[model samples]
Target chain A: MCELLGMSANTPTDLCFSFTGLTQRGGNTGPHKDGWGVAFYEGKGVRLFHDPQPSCSSPIAELVQSYPIKSKTAICHIRQANVGEICLANTHPFVRERWGRYWVFAHNGQIANFSRQPGPCEPVGDTDSENIFCDLMNRIHHTLPRDAMPEQLAAVLVELAEEYAAQGVFNCLLSNGQWLFTYCSTKLASITRRAPFGPAQLKDADVTVDFEAETTPNDVVSIIATEPLTSDEAWDVYQPGEWKLWECGEVIASGKRQR
Target chain B: MCELLGMSANTPTDLCFSFTGLTQRGGNTGPHKDGWGVAFYEGKGVRLFHDPQPSCSSPIAELVQSYPIKSKTAICHIRQANVGEICLANTHPFVRERWGRYWVFAHNGQIANFSRQPGPCEPVGDTDSENIFCDLMNRIHHTLPRDAMPEQLAAVLVELAEEYAAQGVFNCLLSNGQWLFTYCSTKLASITRRAPFGPAQLKDADVTVDFEAETTPNDVVSIIATEPLTSDEAWDVYQPGEWKLWECGEVIASGKRQR
Candidate 1:
């Protein structure tokens, strides 16, 4: 299995603190040492940094930790080779442009022997994760209108997620800058911080960050990850077959897929 | 207007020398400093780095210069922001996937009052350059087969380039990792360095590099840019209606678009 990290915020925010903790798991604290990628959405643009290197030792990862690229929505992944070879093409957080918007997707767990009919949206990489993302894009393009409502999009996403989850693990994070949609098949967790934010210590790294000193009272930031990143915060663990649609750091809608 | 830089090589090569010189034009030595972006092709994958800040002082540019990300093909751009605002969305070197391959494009000139019928491919940013690219993509999708030959693609590209160039300036560089197609509407230059290489000095910066020390005898590296980057190299200037198809650091085909 790999690791996934996602963020949705009311205001532009940096993922340095949470990202630093996750990098530790990429090689130092865990065995997911293949590659990692992150996408930070600024308005309608997404700045992507991908490195086919171990996060703990990659210079690009180091820059990501030191530089504060603020964004309203973001998705990141650290991969452990399970279904694809260790290469830049097989890196996570695959991106595609659809409906005049950039869509970013990242997967955590594997879906064994997954295959689908080819369509307009094709996978550039040889990974089951990318294949599934392309399949999802094809379905969205064919099933929904260009200006479909967010709820309509979410419904389609949940239906596909449930189908894929039935084959194997299918936890994923997807976004189109306006909203973040996350689905859990086996493991997922999330935490939201607002006005009462306090200092939190990382579970993987010996680092502490005071959210009170960094964030404004009006700031609302939600973080979703495959595992809890902080020890002090009460992260809400998602039940299998559960999914949520996030916008402006809060869940607007959620549902449990009937197994 | 904007500045474009591209490289095609028989072997994987780094563009640190040329990139360092061109970055000096991004608000240091010249006035094209709205934003900058680069796409480096690794196998079928592409590593894209975009910064809305001036490249001369941007930390991301600093990282690119310091780190040698080798690739066989690469495309870069530095924008001056005439047709679009100074934002990440308006940054150049836009990318899209077509026929399961990433197509990277960067424009150095503008196409004023450009409008085309809606198609499957759409422009995410509000730039005339991106609009032209989307139109080109739509044309390719509808006009040619998925497995079209390089010459067929080039013929179609030249026809479109002539049409757009007649409307306004339309210098551009496009690549799909297999071949690089460059069209020069006004200003463009190129240089190919192979065996018997010597020292070269940057025109914008006080930096010198000895090609003999870095490259093997069998290496064939070609660079295409809006202007000659090095002071000592004899660059071949392209005519207003000229285009070339480059692969493995050599021009496999060349032609002039008749007005």
Candidate 2:
């Protein structure tokens, strides 16, 4: 299992403050130090970076920390090796083209005996995570209408996810430049920040940030993770077999636990 | 990248309606058949299953489809391969003990050079995903106060995630029996369902369901995915850098994307 990090905000914001603490887990504070990656949504486009190196020491990671790319959404991960050999191709936050738009994904859990004949979408690496992304694209290309509604597509995704989860562990985060979708079988947690911004402290490194100084009274920000990243903020824990759909930094819908 | 499936409802709902369609992608329709897994959250606990086989043909997966394990939340996944060898140890929906509760997680992306000396927490398998998960636990154990608020913890998580994202791909889902946190760096999409119910069809498989027939007027559900899963529903895409905190089937807070 790997660490997952996500953010959604009502206003364009920088994740640098929060990200600073997360990177420490890549090696300094945690174990997920194989390689790391992150993607930032800017308007209708995305800025992505990946490296097959420990985030704690990766110069690229350092660069990201110093750069304050602003957007409304972001996803990041630090890896620890489960499937493919360590390499850049096997990095998380895998990106692809779909419906003329770019799609990105990252996972923290492993699937067993997962093997599929490559479809038109091919994996750049041997990781099961990348292969799964390709296969999902292939399915979307083959099944969805050119102009499908988000709800309709979500239903289809639910169907697909159910099938996959039945075969093994299936907690994940997915996005397509419009909204963020999350599904958890186990070990998922989240925190939402709105209006009354406050102070926060990092658990990975000796760092702190006063969100009140960085955000506005109308700003709404949310953060998701495999575990709580701070020592002072409140984080909600996702029940096993729970999921939610998010748009514009708010959950428009949700589901009950699947037993 | 991996395939994700999620179901939420006012009442405990069985995912059979959607699982039927998603299973096709495990092998017959898509390529995420490396292994499959599913978890149904029953109240505070979770019922999980993992198979090192293609969901399309896995007997376990078939059993899951047939079993109407109903709950408020459910998560599923189909793997393609990225981290460790395709085996049970590598299967996802990884579970851990935290704050006197069980936590679960699954992933769809890969990390590059995530190598860290395992502390008290160690990966059961060789997959980067597992390693990351264990690392997260180790960090949480040593960092967060056992009685910290969920929101405070989330702030810390955001910081850590930003750090990991700097290193490489980091898209993921995490839960701890109360809330779901989602982070998107590249590709993630989500849909929320509430009040008015409608009919839905799967894109990969010839399957359809009428929410009006299966859900109540007060039912609110959400589904998250890497891509839109249906051909008709409107799904919101996540920005390049965004994350959301979800609770009770709704988005409570979100984070902004920073490049």
Candidate 3:
């Protein structure tokens, strides 16, 4: 399995602290040293970087650790190959164009005997995750309007996620330069930050930060991950078979279990 | 890159609705079809599944979509190869034993020059993402105390994540069967849901659901993603160089930006 990291904030923020800690996991702390990638959202645009190398020792990873790229939204991944070969084309945090906007996705699971016919959106590699993404695009193109409401689109997405969960593991993160949609089937967790910031420590590295000093009282930042990256802060656990829609660092809608 | 889908709720919920919508993206609407995986957290334990096939056509994905897996915290992913070969070892939602519990992760993005050196926790696959995960484990073992607080861990994790972000993209999701920590360097967004549930639809599929009918007044659910999956709903965006801690479907603490 892989690792996932994401952030949504009310203010433009730099991910320097969290990035540093997560980098250690790339090669220093954790066991998923396959590959790594990350994407940042900046005012309706996205900036992405990917490498077929471990983040612990990668020069690029080092550079990211030192640089402070500011944005409103971000997504990152570290891979553990389960389906595709170790190559640049098979890295996580895949990006695509949809409705004239950039969409990004990443995964940390596998589907059993999953296959799909070619579609308008094609995978650059042979990973099943990419194939699934393309298939979703095809379906989207064939279904809702390009400018549908978030609620409408979310309903359909929930339906599709439920269908996939029925088949096998379907843990995933997806974005379109706007909202972050998260769904879990097994082991996913998240944390959100608002007023009354506090201190935090990294479980993977020897470092700490006092969010109270860096954030405004009105700021709201939310994060979702497969696991907790820090050790001191309190994090909320997502219930199984649940999904939430996040907008501007707040959840607007969600799905419930059918009894 | 990989795709992530998560669901959170105030009450125990089934992911049948959103899973159906997200599964289509695995092979039909999106490009992260390399493989798929999911974990359903039932209380403290988790039910997980993985497969190295496109989710659209994978029997496993189909089963997940059809099955009504219920839990409070869940994580799912679909991969698009960028570092490791197409094999089961390269699949995501990687799990590990930590603090006498299971930790899970899913990632999106890549790091350059990550495979030069092997860390204490080596990558099971060739993907740089896996190597990074191993490195993180190694760092945790070396840096943090066995019974460190979540906030302390978050601080160190933020420092490490910042370092990695300087090198390249470092957005990610991580969990320790308790809380989820997420960091964003780029392209991360999210939404939180509580009372006033309404109808929602999918941008990629022709499906819709009325949350008001399916949820109670006390329901609170949150989601984080690489992008906004829906078209109608308003999704919050994450600022670059930011991280958040989540617990019980709510935001807790946040990081400061140094960029």
Scored by lDDT, the top model is 1
Best by DockQ: 1
**Recovered native contacts in candidate 1, as a fraction?**
0.56
Per-residue lDDT, model 1, residue B16, is 94
Model 3, B1-259: lDDT tens per residue?
A: 7767666555677776666666677779988788877776655445556667787777656666765666666777778898777665577776544443445677778888864333324454567766676667667767888677888889877887787777777777777656677888886777787779888887777888787887789887777777766777898788999887776677677775775
Q: Report the C-alpha lDDT of model 2 over B1-259, residue by residue, as the tens digit.
A: 6777665445677878677777788888888888877777665545566667789997657767775777666777778888767765577766654553445676667777787544444555567776676677667767788676768777866666665566676666677656666767677778887768889888887777788987778777777776777878999898866877666667777886666
Q: Which stretches in model 1 have alpha-carbon errors above 4 Å?
A: none
Per-residue lDDT tens digits of candidate 1, residues B131-211? 899899988899989898888988898998888899999999999899999999999999999999999999999999999
lDDT over C-alpha atoms for residue A148 of model 1: 83
Best by TM-score: 1
Report the TM-score measured on chain A for model 3. 0.95
Q: Residue-wise lDDT of candidate 3 within A1-259, one digit each (tens)? A: 7888787777877777887777777767887788888887765445555667788887656656766666677888888888888765577787655554557788767787777655445665667776677677667767779787889988877777777777777777788767887878666777888878889998888888898998899888888888887898888887778888887788878886584
Place model 3 in a CAPRI quality band. incorrect
lDDT of 3: 0.73
- TM-score to true structure, per model: 0.99, 0.50, 0.50
